[model samples]
Target: MLNKKVLSCAFEKTINIEWHKGQFTTNNFLHILIHELGHIFYFYDWETFKINHIFYLKQFLGHKINNLNKFSELDKEKVLKIFANSNYGLSDDDELLAEGFAYWLLTKQSMQTKIWEFWNEYFTSYLPQIRDKERKEV
Candidate 1:
């Protein structure tokens, strides 16, 4: 089996926005940043996540990902839907999670409580290291 820590995730960092009245704002960019941060949060915590919560993640996601390459399109989507909050998030599992987390952080209300708890644990446990790492780099 592929190691969960070796699996990849993609994310956006910066975005370009057109300036217009009553349109997008810095808050929109903050949401995108929050989504990207969720991906980083997972990246930095992959080992612990795999060791402790892989089964829960798979179960909560509602599809077996061990053979993702062989999944039928419909089957793939069934799993992805649990994390995707928008059509844009339907690309794959990672986006589903990132986008779903963005919505979760903003609303704080959803049926995705399992994922929320996972993220909460991740952040609770890792925030200190993350802050220290960035602080040292600065």
Candidate 2:
């Protein structure tokens, strides 16, 4: 059976805005929306993502010093910046990707940082292909 998932957002209530430092601004809403879209994007091609990206990300953050050692200094710095952008992302690889995606789309500083290169690559290369495939199916 195909499973269905729901993503709910209540913009009117203060409770929904609390996690965003208690402000209900358009920027905050955009961040939340983009972050959730990132999750949807991940789930859309989960098998490919799990094999290509998640495995390496898990190893880099996992409990082994040797795994961390395998990454270059630049790569490590980029990963740290991703976590720094949103501490919530530290919970897991999926959050990391979502947070990175939000930061890449919403923050001006993100353009200068290599931290969001993965998102750039995905958007420029994979997104068009995904769109084209959907168009053909329809």
Candidate 3:
């Protein structure tokens, strides 16, 4: 069985500590892990090792990089910069695909703690703004 305390502690170590406090349950952690794992599985299918490796290299070299398990608000800013400069914002196709895949994976299982609900809300708010910039660039 999953431990709510341990899961909440892990969440606290990340960016959403205060905001997500008392918000996440054990089931929430399972959903998050499964969501991330979905992204990993998708990348494998999409032959994204090249770009993913580059991303990891930049991360290891101390560049501000955000992967599924490790996204901070700063990474969100970087994505905004990418949206300002490129069609996809700062997110590459792989990242976008991963996000979608995560949502899909969440649907394949029972969701607890309303984590999927929060994720959907976040995507609904952010994706359009990013996409609006892309549309204007066209």
RMSD for each of the candidates = 13.5, 9.2, 14.0
Best by lDDT: 2
Residue 15, candidate 3: how far off, in angstroms?
Answer: 4.4
Model 1 agreement with the true structure over 1-138: per-residue lDDT tens digits: 644233322212223322132122222555766778867655554543332223334443443246764667677556646555555566555555566557667654655576566555444554445545655655
**Model 1 clashing residue pairs (backbone):** none
Better of 1 and 3 by lDDT: 1
Predicted candidate 2 versus true structure: per-residue lDDT over 10-59, tens digit per residue: 34344355566522223365687788887876676564433334544444
TM-score: the better of candidates 2 and 3: 2
Global Cα lDDT for candidate 3: 0.43
Writing each residue's lDDT as its tens digit, candidate 3 over 2-114 gives 58787667675662552254322223565556546746754553362233422332343233233623666565445433312212212454444444445544564564334
Q: lDDT of all the models against the reference?
A: 0.51, 0.56, 0.43
Better of 2 and 3 by lDDT: 2
Q: Arrange candidates by TM-score, descending.
A: 2, 1, 3
Two-way TM-score contest, 1 vs 2, winner: 2
Q: Specify the highest-TM-score model's number.
A: 2
